[model samples]
Target: MTKSQPYTQADLAKLGNVLIYLVDRLGPISKTKALKLIYLVQEVSVKTYGLPFFNMPFLVWRLGPVAEDVFVDLSAEEPVLLANYIQRQEEDCKTFIHASQPFSDDEFSDNEMEILALVAKTYGSLSAERLVEVIHRPHSLWYQTARENGVLDYLEQGRMTTTNFEIDFGRLLDDMPERKRMYTGQLDYLEQSRALKV
Candidate 1:
């Protein structure tokens, strides 16, 4: 059966999301599987990559001629904040961007804390608003996804302000019933910190 040639926005989003998750858990990334994911998506040559697009799309697949995988440089060029990612998304109308800088510190709370930690080592520090932007992906499906994903219930003034992140953390620690397995996982992260020298 013949397969598709072009990659859809969702496919692109999927790759972007997966890469984002990988960056959160790991740090920095290699260009090795960049081509593999695209080829599997396009089914172009049973090894298709992707068309070169501007905005650096976080991914690239040089199908016909170059025959290579290309990834965008999500470098911090400058300190990135919530405004940075949000403004860029508003300008580009897409979430294909990646982080080019990283900073690790326990400067956040709630999902913001870990989310911040995850991106810290890759995207640097993000403002609560910027963190909200990442949490607001279309696939995230607000309201439902917010709670399911342990993102909502963390908002303050109906917005995910930094204060809300701390509030969420405090509330989670105080009210165990509302906590999810992810909450337990975060606790483990904190526990690990206690094991440290500093």
Candidate 2:
């Protein structure tokens, strides 16, 4: 609504909790790995400590290649921040976004918003194994969550399920002049027209 109020601290906590919930829901995460992760996060942030916006992209941006160095305790060969790094650019609250680009103030579509909400809910909570469970089919048949081959079922569903939200979920796309229609609309201000302007 208003840029004056940033996301509340409580919102962050809820988001974090939701992430944890999603992970657990998708889990059979071993207690050992979970505990190890908790401890490792606590430990590793030590050197990279006190950085205000502790997003992975920011760390990687500032540290460059050094950030590629692993967090040995976690057993990760490459240390990585575990979220979909979205940016908020104030002089103080600078963060990251998709494709390493600055996010603008444009409104998101309902489905896109839902996708974000799901992600915020699912973020830090889900382990790699759990996330792979929800997002991708497990490589082994034993791991299938669906009664049938869930991955194959999902692939067939995806074929026609409007996978690209930018176009699919966007109301503006619906507002666009339909194909094979007459040129009743102007293209001057459309994003695709920008390059053509020159």
Candidate 3:
């Protein structure tokens, strides 16, 4: 969600584990959809826990937010972390990533596992088009980052640091309603935009 440090191998492994876990739950999914799921998990985790789940750097791409490192690895001939567990395929002319084997939840902490499960349950079923809409919501990290940087990579780790946000019970409770409205309004706007484009 925010500009974080480049991921280490272990981080990629943990992220790969989350990806595989989601693939198992949702079936083979498009790469774009997979990236959105990863972004959403990080976004929610950052807001709720004050620390991002994977510490992966994300950029504001034309499609929305993308973890370029993860994308490159998955597209590699032998993916760094997902080599044995994932396979890339083309179906109906669309690229998709499918799990080659079942995933184990051993690498993830209880909190990480909880967030992964929650994200998968809430968003795994959505189409990629819908995900882009949800992610571009007003006040979302993607929206803010894109507005500030245009299409450039998010390189402001200082601003994204947990220290920048003071998370308190009262603050969270107060912000929840506004966040809900932002999410709803963004979806409505996206639908209208899509209609206009069509």
Candidate 4:
């Protein structure tokens, strides 16, 4: 989609639940780590299921893939969307996120829940800086998008800038030819269906 899109109330609730789930499983986490974990969950879900866990658009930021709205909400002094589900606390000069409410799986499918657990188990223990390094690896979607958008060059030149490049989720299928074919076919069907709706 575009670099940003408005999330419906249902969408915000689902995102909030997911965040609470992560916080409950991983213990209190940094905003950076929580954001990266969300990205990882999306990445794994796309690669394995041929769809994203959430409809949220990820931007190729300097650290990694970031959902701008979630980032802003988490950083806000009073979070509007996730205020009921998560709370931010400052300790040792760093902000940590905690679950303010019990997580509900109502918004997730069985497969989605599995993927969430898998991502938490796989990357939960890593520090935010470590997660950043992981996402920066060659061939990672964030790395590829950032490189294409000149964010990498900007960093190499030691220039300070705010770059928000949309990460192309379709590229996740590049290495899987069969999956790519299937994914494209589904996309074609979707386009046709939308056209019919018009």
Q: What is candidate 2's lDDT per residue for 1-198, written digit by digit as tens? A: 111223333333333332243334333233222332332232222212211111111011111111121122112322133232211122333221112223321333344334434443534465544533432334222122221423344433443221111101111133444521211132222323433432
lDDT for 42 in candidate 4 is 80
For all predicted structures, in order, the TM-scores are: 0.21, 0.21, 0.69, 0.86
Give a tens-digit lDDT track for model 3, residues 4-79.
3344455556777777898888988988898899888877665565444664456666564777767777566556
Query: In candidate 4, which residue ranges exceed 4 Å CA deviation?
Result: 1-4, 156-158, 181-198
- The root-mean-square deviation over C-alpha atoms between each candidate and the true structure, in angstroms, is 19.5, 17.7, 13.2, 3.4
Off by over 4 Å in 1: 1-4, 33-198
How many residue pairs clash (N, CA or C atoms closer than 3 angstroms) in each of the candidate models, in the order given? 8, 7, 0, 0
The whole-model lDDT of each prediction reads: 0.30, 0.27, 0.65, 0.80
How accurate locally is residue 9 in candidate 1, as Cα lDDT from 0 to 100?
A: 40
- Highest TM-score: which candidate? 4
Clashing pairs in 1: 39-48, 50-61, 74-99, 74-100, 75-100, 76-100, 82-130, 103-120
The candidate that achieves the highest lDDT relative to the unseen native structure: 4
Cα deviation of 2, candidate 4, in Å: 3.6
Candidate 3, position 194, lDDT: 39
* Native-referenced Cα lDDT, model 2: 0.27
Q: Which one wins by lDDT: 2 or 4?
A: 4
Which of 3 and 4 is the better model by lDDT? 4
